[model samples]
Target: MNDKKEIRNILLLVFVIIIVGALIIAKFYGNNQKERYNISVIAGEAHAERWVVLQQGLEKAGNDYNAQINFYTVVNGKDAREQKDLINRELEKKVDAIIVCAVDSQEIQEVLQKSERRTPVILIETDLKPGHLYSQVSPDNYEMGYHLGEEFVRQQEGKETTAGILIDNDKIAAQQERLKGFEEALASAKNITIKWRASDYQSNERVDNIIGMDCVGTQNATEISKVNNEKISIYGFGNAEANIYYMDKGIIKALVVPNDFNMGYLSVQNAVQAVEKDMVYKNTIVEYIVVTGDTLHNEENQRIIFPLVQ
Candidate 1:
């Protein structure tokens, strides 16, 4: 009888140990299974028209991907030294990765090299010089330009039409690609001539000057078939969506739309994914809309695409 009691006590002790061990293992597994990442976005400016929608999209992406986004704004992207210093500060934070909308395409490479030494970078809403950057998530600027170019060809079927670009006039990825795509799309058309000289290259002053240039189309409803600036069709890039609503009651035939909110949100989410998985994205092209008369009139349409935010 004494031996049997001792055996029963030992069995109870073993059962308790097994249950305790299973509980500990379950706790550790649950903690490790959850994935999280940290990300940063370097926006050119806080008040930029496009930045608003980009912010909304970024928020949406964050909710979807389970990540966090932090934004760093510069007074102006053109100030290279200041921009570099800003990047250095972000690097110190040891973010998993960074997303950039560079102010100057040329000088940004230096910043990229410095940050990339410690973490990966994803370029968003713009392009980067091709060698070492992680990935680019942006709208197809050139394709959007091509769509605009096609608008000129269709409208002027038989008439001679001229087109111009309002751009920064730099080697920036977005600017160069857009200019290239616009020209290619219009390459075969003889009646439509793209202005060899871009009258208003990208400058804050130039962007500010376009009160009613009809960068896309003659937005005035006064005359449905004719343009106010009949001879010239202008293409504005940044915050181009504003032209949709701001112009008098008419439709602009061609404009480029950026999915800013999505870009903002995805940039953060992708950076987090890169950190958690130790991986990076390649050739991730965000969506861009080619707005013509049919699409631009609806404010809701504009909101759905890029959400005229700034």
Candidate 2:
């Protein structure tokens, strides 16, 4: 009887020791693994060209930092109501953070402000009217416009030139800023006559130069110039593959390409920092490049022009 009791006690002690050892190993691994975060991105439009590059950046950063990105967009770029609804839905779903491209700066300001109370909010491209956004990632629209204007000035070489400017009619702040900066650059140039027109307008006015203020505008101007067979010099902003193709074919004379991939990657990176380290809000103005036919294939620009995800 004594021998049987001793044997049972020994077996029970061994089982407890094995169970405790298993739990200690499990705890060590659990502590070593970093917690993955859920991040949501709300874009102005679905399948927009700019967003394509930006999405690549976002995905790359998400992979590097162990984040799950939930990307959402409205069918219409200017649909503020839909954007508001989407923001509400994401908030209810309890996403860790939100990165938004405001369709109407004013219309969505209140919603964004409210959402910020619950989670960290970062703006991409367009910012709010009151400028209350704690953080934003975008290119300097004014600088880009000014740079394109400078390129035009260089090409014209102070010769008298007739030019038409094409810009989006959405009246977003970014577009407006681009227009303002371009106009300011041209303000001191006495040899150019400016004809301002909305992107939707189709006019037969033959001009020596055509300028577009954004990706869609650039593509539209390029198409119009091609279809009309107008002997015109084209300059605009964007890094769409189509724009690059046009540049290669000499259809686009000058292109202002914003680093949208950086925009995407940095915005998410900032959001993650805000969540984990309680980082303060900051505005990160991404870089841009002015590429001409002659300089398009340079090694520095090629990386941005043809981004490869590793």
Candidate 3:
């Protein structure tokens, strides 16, 4: 009788243990299978060629992290008002997070700040004015500009040269920083002087060199150089297809290419992290590379300039 009672108690304990273990395993698996997060991205330019690589990076991250990305762009070019309106619309829908390449830092600062209180916000390419509420994932604009300036100075054979700067929008905070760094770099070399700074090309103005502060500015300068059959040396930022074509044709002297793929991938990855893990976001500086006509076809540079089709 005693042996039978002992055996019954042991079986009862084993059954309870099995049931508890099953419950714990189910709970753990359920936690691991989190629902996919929804993230929204608003780029400064809707049709910029550089976005191709960036969008790929974003999509890769989204796939890796189980996120659904909704990309938005300004239909009427780079307009701060349009960006604000988009932000409001996203907020109304209550997205999990927002990633924006601001058109005008000042114009969208307040709206972004308010939006951050309710949703996670991330900045790309440029950051807002000081004391911003969100984090940025971009190349060091000032440093990039400075390096481009240094490259320009290196190209000089100790001859006096006049350079004109073309920028898409002076209001863009990234452009402003790049412009500052370029100017400061030029300041050290008295031989090179900035003849004029304009948003659009000046047909009447002539200069030995033209420096584009953004991809649009670069493409504009390249097109102007090709059309006018001018002998001006063009140097600017971006790895756009147009830029590459011009560089191959020797119309563009050099380019400062940013890791746009990393920018896109990290932005999405960071956004997902901010939502799931409550991670404290901070500035994540991506890398950049300088490509000249001589080095454009090199294996390493090609990897940076051209995105791999996966």
Tell me the TM-score of each prediction against the true structure: 0.72, 0.91, 0.88
Residue runs of model 2 more than 4 Å from their true location after superposition: 1-10, 114-116, 128-133
Better of 2 and 3 by lDDT: 3
Residue 270 in candidate 3, Cα distance off native in Å = 1.0
| lDDT (10s digit) by residue, model 2, range 65-141 | 89999999999877889999998898888888888888787766777666545577788877454343348888888
**lDDT, model 3, position 23:** 100
lDDT of each: 0.59, 0.83, 0.86
* Tens digits of per-residue lDDT for model 1, 1-310: 9999999999999999999999999999988775655667786744555566677777777667765778677886456667667777777887667777776676777667655464778776456645454667777777766775666566667676544444443445676676677667778888765443342333322111121112222222112223343322334443334565533234344556666666776677666666666664555667756566566647665565645332
**How does residue 110 of candidate 1 score in lDDT?**
67
Which stretches in model 1 have alpha-carbon errors above 4 Å?
1-36, 114-116, 129-133, 169-171, 193-234, 237-241, 297-303, 306-310
Give the CA lDDT, 0 to 100, for residue 77 in model 1. 44
For model 2, give the 10-residue run with minimal summed lDDT. 125-134
Order the numbered candidates by TM-score, best leading.
2, 3, 1
Clashing pairs in 3: none
